[model samples]
Target: MKLPKALAFDVFGTVVDWRTGIAEQAAAFLARYMPGTDPGAFADDWRNLYQPAMEECRSGRRPFRLLDALHLETLVQLLERRGIGTAAIGEGELLDLAYAWRRLRPWPDVPPGLAQLRKLFPVVTLSNANIALMIAMNRFNGLEWDAILGAEVSRSYKPTPQAYLASAAALCLDPQDLCLVACHHSDLAAARACGLQTAYVDRPMEYGGARAPDGSYEQAWEWRAGDLLELVRVFTSH
Candidate 1:
């Protein structure tokens, strides 16, 4: 495979353990706000709303909103379904809960692996996360990124051609010159369709093992690896 000019990453499940991070933060919030709630289940429930919320914007049913906004909206909905009214929680508290996304813990391989990858090519985020949230995660995780470009810059969500094309454009490279690294095959398929190279990185525990790992693809990709470190090895080997 030809070397890519830049490596665009899908941040959430690919780089960080969002489920664990959200559950950890939710535990404290739930203890005080809604005692006896199962934080892990709560985290899963909140995450289950992710795609449908983005689909609203993706389908043009609503104007594009930041992931932060969508997260807050979903959190409110989740809480309401539990019989907790918005009036029961202060806006400050709600915003703090939403900010949990910004403080996610990186997968064990991510920080060092990304540092190694950056030496070879410009490594930037191609995530649905907004710039501000990405900034916070970068700081929180000590991640080194060449740039942060994705849905916010593209004004569209992943699986949409615009998100992939716009992210490549942000780096002043042809879509084929950027390799999208993601755990989700659907995201990689979308990038491939947009003329970008694709790398499938296995993240078996992304959903905390609730779902089966999707290592299979309809067709071979430019690369595949078990983790970011393995991806670095693949690049160097090529």
Candidate 2:
């Protein structure tokens, strides 16, 4: 198989451990306000709203908004359902909680593995995350990237053709020359449909192993690895 000219990563679950990071912050925030709430459960519920929130923008039912805004909107809704209102939790505190997305920790293998992979191909993030949040995550996690390209750049979310295609275009590469590396099959499937190459990186703990991860795909992708390190091995061996 031909090697890709560049590699595009899906950041939220694939590169960073969003669930754990969010849970840690949520735990702190909840302890102060909603003392009895389960932070992990709260994190899960917050994440559950991710797709539907983006779907509104993806379907053109709403104009494009940054993930940060979408996150805050959902967080407010979640809090209200639990009998907490914006008046109870001031806007500044709410903003802090919403900004927790910017401080996620990377998966254990991510830093070194990504460093090695960068030696072989240009690696850039193609995530739904807005630029400021991505920048914060990179700084917080010591992740060095060639570029950040995704929803904010494309003005569209993943599973939408524009998100993948625009990222490749931004890199001055053809869709086929850029391989999308993601933990989600649905993400890879979407990239594949848009003419980009695909690599599946298994992230079984993405959801804290609450159930099986979204690891299944109908057709084989161009590459599959247990993690970024394994993908590095695949590239070097070839």
How do the residues 128-233 of candidate 1 rate in per-residue lDDT, one tens digit apiece?
9999999998888888788999999999998899999999888899999999999888888889999999998888888888763344544588999999899999
Task: After superposing candidate 2 on the true structure, give the runs of residues whose Cα lies further than 4 Å from its correct spot.
Answer: 212-218
**Model 2 reaches what TM-score against the true structure?**
0.96
TM-score of each: 0.96, 0.96
Candidate 1 local Cα displacement, residue 185, angstroms: 0.8
The segments of candidate 1 whose C-alpha lies over 4 angstroms from its true place after superposition are 212-218
Worst-scoring 10-residue span by lDDT in model 1:
210-219
Error of 1 at 52 (Å): 0.8
lDDT of each: 0.91, 0.91
